[model samples]
Target: MEQTEDEGYHKLDHQLCFPLYAASRLVTKCYQPVLDELGLTYPQYLVLMVLWESDAVNLSRLSERLKLQSNTLTPLLKRMEELGLLTRQRSKQDERSIIIALTEKGKSLKSEVPRLQQQLMDIGISKEEAIQLKGLLTKMINYISG
Candidate 1:
């Protein structure tokens, strides 16, 4: 049998991964302006979301949840602390670990996030579409991670 040179080679247009990567980057860029107004970066916004859901998470746990390394998270957390958005204190029970807690300012920002996120949703996707998109993303991530 004759074989084409293209067999087993990669093609950008046909790759599902590229769309996921591109969409992720674009979505992060879209969030940048909204987050900037709150004095936050996309990663910081992610941290805020995690902390908003549960306020006093340990450093390691936050890093794991956010898929960040301790070195990277440490600086980000420090910056958040300097911005008066959150507080970092060494755990009294285990001095080796640190606890990150949202400050009043950070807690107050939660109300504004819904409005900002809604704006993105309204412009980028409908509510029903967004739910379906979320499910699709979850499935993709789970499959890739698995």
Candidate 2:
């Protein structure tokens, strides 16, 4: 019998994107419990991590760092602001720009980051494998972005 189009290809197993999507979801799932303890969602945790690195940055700069659109980030930032985790203000140099700065409450969460990172150590992958995987993924990201 001649194989049909669906039978010959176009299956989930044949798509490279499927496993990448699944792996990304599963990795995010692994962060759930730990994130709950800190009262953060995955995206919120990401915003905090970025701010921890650079505390006062403009919204456009933040959008670039997070690789998220301003529309998507606005509500997230508003919620974070309401939570007192961060604050947003109009920049003196440019009123058009919103500046984000971690509040004292947000800065206090920095101490718990090691606990969050411990989740990675608990995962089965060895340090070397994790590093290699991150490098490859980063390359893929750069290539796609470039």
The number of the candidate with the highest lDDT is 2
Scored by CA lDDT, what does every candidate get?
0.83, 0.88
Q: What TM-scores do the predictions have?
A: 0.84, 0.89
Compare the candidates by TM-score and give the number of the best one: 2
Name the lDDT value of residue 49 in candidate 1.
90
Once fitted onto the true fold, the runs of candidate 2 whose alpha carbons sit more than 4 angstroms away are 1-9
Across 1-146, the per-residue lDDT of candidate 1 in tens digits comes to 24355763365776677888998898788787778787788888888899999877999999878777999998888998999999999999999989999999888888878766754764566789888988998887778656
Which pairs of residues collide in model 1? none
lDDT of 2 by residue, 5-101 (tens): 8685567776767888998898888888989988899999999999999888899988988889999999999999999999999999898999999
**What's the TM for model 2?**
0.89
Clashes of 1: 0
State the lDDT at 99 in candidate 1.
Answer: 94
